[model samples]
Structure formats: C-alpha cells, structure tokens
Target chain A: MPTVHVQLFKGRTADQKRAAAAAITEAVVATLGGNAATVDVIFHDIERHDWATGGKLWSDQPPAPPTPAAP
Target chain B: MPTVHVQLFKGRTADQKRAAAAAITEAVVATLGGNAATVDVIFHDIERHDWATGGKLWSDQPPAPPTPAAP
Candidate 1:
C-alpha cells in the first residue's frame, strides 16, 4: 500500500480534497505501479501561525499575492 | 532543511505537542547534525475514519486497549 501525506494550508474545501485525492491516486498508480484502491492520500491542514520559513512565521509575514486569473 | 511529519490520532493537547516537538527536534539534531532552529516538526492529527489499514478503516475497528500503567 502506498500512502501519500500532503501538507496544505487550512481552508481547502471538501471538494478540493476529493479532487486532489482522485488525481493523486491516479498519478501514483500510473507512475508507481500500485492499485488505485490501495492508495491513500492523507491531508494535513496547517495554520499560518504553525508554519514558518527562514525563521519567520507565515502568520507574521505579508500574505502572498493572489494568483492572476488566466485569460 | 529536515522536516519531520508525524501523524497521530486526534485529541492530543498543546502541552503534549510542545513536548513532542522539542524532543523530536533534539533527536533530529543529534542524529542528523542539523541546527535545532532549522528543524521543523509538524504534527498531523488524523481522524479514525480517515485512516485505514489492511482494507479496514480504523473507525470501523474496535478501540485499542488502554496502555498499562507503570508498576
């Protein structure tokens, strides 16, 4: 059994998780030769205050700019 | 940078997390020769229903017996 652990910022919708789990399972099965039913995608939601980079907490830093919409 | 991700059953207290993080950071630094300040220990609290082993969900199984107290 192949288990994938994904760390993500909190606030992702259930729909997002569902889509991600399906896509990840497909990719893992295709690339790693595992059964789709045996694949597990576990998500860990982290808050900004709990995550840090370069000695600075994400909560203390300026928010990232929003992604631009494609034309 | 070395990042340690720990997945555990939910309901852990903040004090437990603090102790775990400190101990894990110390171990990683001692074993791997990394700065304690640069090490990251992330805890992921997972629900029983979300985790499965041997084709069975943890929530569907009987609760684990409590650990024995020290003599």
Candidate 2:
C-alpha cells in the first residue's frame, strides 16, 4: 500500500485533483508495482493565510479565493 | 510553507522523483499560487513488508525492485 499525500496551496478544481490522483495511481501501479486499489491519494488544501514562503505569509496579499468547488 | 510527503513503494529513480517534484511544484505555483523555492516534496520509499492493505501484505507477493537511481 502506497499512500501519497499532496499538500497544495488550496485552489484547484476537483477535476484537476481527480486527474492528478489518477495519474499518480497509474504511476504507482505501473512503475512502482503497487496495487491500483491499494494506492491512496490525499489532498490537503491550505488557505493563503495559512501558507508561507521565505518567512512571508501568502494571506498578507491574498489572491481572491477562487470560486467554490463546482456543484 | 507547505511540505508534501509522498510514501511510495521502495523502488524509483531519484530523477523520476525529482521530475515528479518539479511537476508538483509547478502545479502549486501556477494553480495554487505558491512560491517555487518554498515548495518541499519529500519521498519516502517503504519496504513492501512495511505496507499493507485490505488485511493483506505487499511483501508477500513483492515484485522485484527496480534499477537504482542514475548516478
């Protein structure tokens, strides 16, 4: 069982995330010899305010949050 | 600062991992508005014996490990 955890800055479409998961799962199964069903992918979305770089906060100049997840 | 940890089966080239990291970092920067330098991607190679799913072990039917990372 291979668990892939991806922490992104929290502004991607569900379709993008799903595609990423599928691509990663395929890579694990074909390249790494992992069972497809056993491959687990989790996504953590961080708020701009919660993310930082070079000791600076992203929320300080936060880009407007993208539209909510497509319903 | 966001740190992404990926637990993969213990057999992939360093270059492959590096590529994966770069792609992910690009996605984070472009899609999620994260800084490129601050994106950290860590890969943990787990022994098949250490991984399990559906109450079964991966090591029991382990596929042979792949070639070592390119020098």
Choose the strongest candidate by lDDT: 1
**Residue lDDT tens for model 2, A1-71:** 56878777676688777776776566555544545776788988888878776787877865644433212
In model 2, pairs of residues that clash are A52-B1
- Give the lDDT of residue A69 in candidate 1: 45
Model 2 has an lDDT value of: 0.65
- Writing each residue's lDDT as its tens digit, candidate 2 over B1-71 gives 34667797776787667776776555544443445676687889887788776776787875645433222
Model 2 residue B16 CA deviation in Å: 5.0
* DockQ, structure candidate 2: 0.24
Residue-level lDDT tens digits of model 1 in B1-71: 69887789987766566666767777777898867778876767789999999999999999999987455
Per-model TM-score (chain A alone): 0.90, 0.77
Residue A23's lDDT in candidate 1? 88
C-alpha lDDT values of all predictions: 0.78, 0.65
